[model samples]
Target: MKITFPHMGNAHIAIKALLAGLKLEVIPPPPITKRTMELGIKHSPEFACLPLKISVGSFIEALEQGADTVLMAGGWGPCRFGYYAQVERDILKDLGYSFRMVVLEAPDFKLSELLNQIKDLSQKVTTLEAVQATRFAWFKLNAVDRLEFCLAKMLPRVINKEEVLAIYRQALQEIDQVTTRPQVNQVTNKSTAEMEQLQQHDQPLLRLGLVGEIYTILEPACNYDIAEQLGRMNVEVYRSVYISDWVNDHLLGGLVKPSNRREILTSSRPYLNYFVGGHGRETVGNAVKLARQHYDGIIQIGPLTCMPEIVAQSVLGEVGEKEGIPVMTMYFDEHAGATGIQTRLEAFVDMLQRRKKSNQVWEQGEQLNAHVPGC
Candidate 1:
């Protein structure tokens, strides 16, 4: 079967590696762009979340390019994501696209069932081959995450941003060209070293934490590349979630759950004690954690009308007031503009810098007063 899947950040890279290794013909949808957003907006319900629309648009494009089968990750939560696959299937059918849809549910809940699904997808490959392919894909997934984490750390400090970005783009291309885990490791290591060599200031201009729905945070196009924009403004950005961490927690049941996740849930308890939907709990929790860590500001981005983030946004005002950190929430749809996002970011960064300077001055004055003799 000629299969395709939606794009989420660098997920398609690992997915393509896995499916191709299984000896399946893979048809990757084109990179997300305005055209993809337009297609999704035209076909999706006005109130549907942005991710659903973008994914539907991706499938339509893939089908037109001869992909007959689609593989989608299923969910089980209060989040609308749980209903996406079936809804998209119906929508595609109505649009007269002929394709088969395979929805892979949470592997942590039913490991054997998830294995059977993988087995079905890899009918042509032996068990050993499938295992090797899966391992390679997992390696690529972690490697990409590490590379991205490095970028986030280095972006705000680099002397010439374009130099770092060029190397990053090259590293991605090199990783995509390799077929083995060792090659992936070599490329990632080389990229990391190259980034380390870029001239950078001893300290970042500012530090910000990004908390939001997974798709919007990971998909640069969906958020108008907010992280990069912040980086250009010399703000070091830390994301609350990563695809590898999500896979480890939700799919692999790896030995150690991410500490940040546990901390986030705990910190969010005062405001939101239960799962509202989406990443709302995580959003609230991460904001609390970042505030305690003394991050200058926090930004939450999500699709417009997303229930979970909406819930998180409501609680964030109180969190910001209690924690004494600035929090900004941004919602995106097909209509979001980069210029507007940049302007908002610029204003927010200015406010943060002034606040940081004032705090530094106040601390200095307190220290001086403590050392002075009584008069």
Candidate 2:
């Protein structure tokens, strides 16, 4: 059967490899765009969180392309993500979309169990092959993640920003086409090494804390290239979500449900009972944490109409105020454009630089005045 998967951050390539190993055809949903958001908003529940809406949009787009199966992740948490796949599946089924939605659950205790499901996918699905594929996928993922972390650094400084982006796209293309496990390892190592070597200057990079829905933060398309813009402005971007977070949210959180539940309940004791919504509490927690660290600003991104992120953004203002941090909220709709996002980044970066310079000048002036016996 033809297979598809909804886009998640930068996961398209890794998932494609895993599915390819499983001997499936990959019809990746379109790179997220305005039309993508429109499709999602039109079909998904209006009140659903932003990430879910975008996910629904992605699946609909894939379905429209005649894809018959969707490979997706399952989760467990106060975060609605645990239930997102099931709810979305039923929603699409009700809409009369013909497709199979396969949600991969927490890893089974037995390695044999993991191998069996994996073998069912690969024509040559042996225990060895499964292990190889998983390892390859993991290292490649880490390399990709680190590239993002590094790019998030280079991005804020790139002149003719798109110039460096052109190079990054080329680098990603190089990383994605390797044909073997050894090649995957080599590609990951080489690409990461080169990204590290890219030259940089010493502008005090605006320390921008990234707190958002998991999918959007990880997936470049979902944010419509917001991170690239931030990087071009020489902003040091800090991310709150990671593959590790996904593992914890779904894997460990499942094993320690009561403890996890209690932690959520207690931490959010100030808000309502913990938000079962995606990334809402995480966003707030990340913002508060980053502000405490003295990040220059915080940018919270989520799919449009995402309740968790919206609620998080609602409280982040207070968090920023209490901690003396600047917070900017970026909400994306189908029609979101790079130019508009660029405008905001330019404005935000400019403000941060100006404020920083002003503070420095005031302090210097105070020092000079004291020395001159003036005031």
Candidate 3:
């Protein structure tokens, strides 16, 4: 059977590896572009979120490339992501496309059920083969995330950003092609070393924490490469989510690795005490975490009309005021323009820098006052 899945950042690389290991033909959708966005917007309901529209467009592209089956991740939450598969299936069927849809729900502490879903996907594959494939794919997932972390660190520091980007791209390509742990490690180590060696500016860097929907945070196209843009402006960007972390927490039941969900939940207290679905709680929690860490500012990004993020955004003002951290929220749709995003980002960064300078001046004044003799 041939399989295809929606493109979400670097997720397709690990997924392709997994399906290929199971001896299934994989048809990866073309990289997302303006045409893809247009296709999705044309077909999807106007009220649907950006992820839904983009994913629908991805499926249409894949189906046209001879993919007979589509694989989609499922969840159980107030987030509309749980309903995406059914909605897309109906949309595709209306478009007169013939294909099967497989929705693999998050394990939700049910490993056996998740295994059964895998078994259904590859009936002929033995238990041993399935285990091996999953292991290797997991390695690839971690490798990609680690390399990306390295890229994020180097982008703002390096004297030549493009060179670092080139190294990062080559590393991703290598990781995508390798099928073994050692090979993945070799690429990651080599690329990381290369980035580490690049000369960096001596200027102090402002750091920003990025929090919001997983798709908007991870998919550079959707967010217009916000992290990289900030880096180019001499600001460091740290994200609150990673695909590897999500997979471990949801798909593998945290057997391979544990996410910081416990800590995030604890930090989210007072500001947001309960899960509002998607990454809402995580957003508020991570923002609080970053504030405690002394990050210069926080940016919350998500698709337009996203309920969970909207809920999170509502609470962020209080978070910013209480924590003494400036926060900005940017919502995206097919109509989102790069110029507007860049303009707002520049303004936010400028405000943060000015605030930091003012705080420093006030602290210096307090120190001088403490040294003065009272009359």
Q: Which candidate has the highest lDDT of all?
A: 3
The clash tally of candidate 2 reads 13
| Model 3 ranges off by over 4 Å | 372-375
Better of 1 and 2 by lDDT: 1
User: For all candidates, what are the clash counts?
Assistant: 0, 13, 0
CA deviation > 4 Å runs, candidate 1: 108-110, 202-204, 253-260
lDDT per residue (tens digit) for residues 155-273 in model 3: 99999999999999988988988878888899999999999999999988899999999999999878888999999999999999998988877677766786788899899999999
The 0-to-1 C-alpha lDDT of every candidate, in the order given, reads 0.88, 0.71, 0.91
Question: Judged by lDDT relative to the true structure, which candidate is superior, 1 or 3?
Answer: 3
Model 1: which ten-residue window has the lowest total lDDT? 251-260
Error of 3 at 218 (Å): 0.9
Colliding residue pairs in candidate 3: none
- By summed lDDT, the worst window of 10 consecutive residues in model 2 runs over 252-261
Better of 1 and 2 by TM-score: 1
Predictions ranked by lDDT, top down?
Answer: 3, 1, 2
Model 2, which residues run further than 4 Å from truth? 33-38, 47-50, 64-66, 77-80, 94-97, 107-124, 192-204, 243-276, 335-344, 366-375
> What TM-score does candidate 3 get on C-alpha atoms?
0.97
Cα lDDT, model 1, residue 323: 96
Residue 148: error of model 3 in Å?
Answer: 0.8
TM-score of 1: 0.96
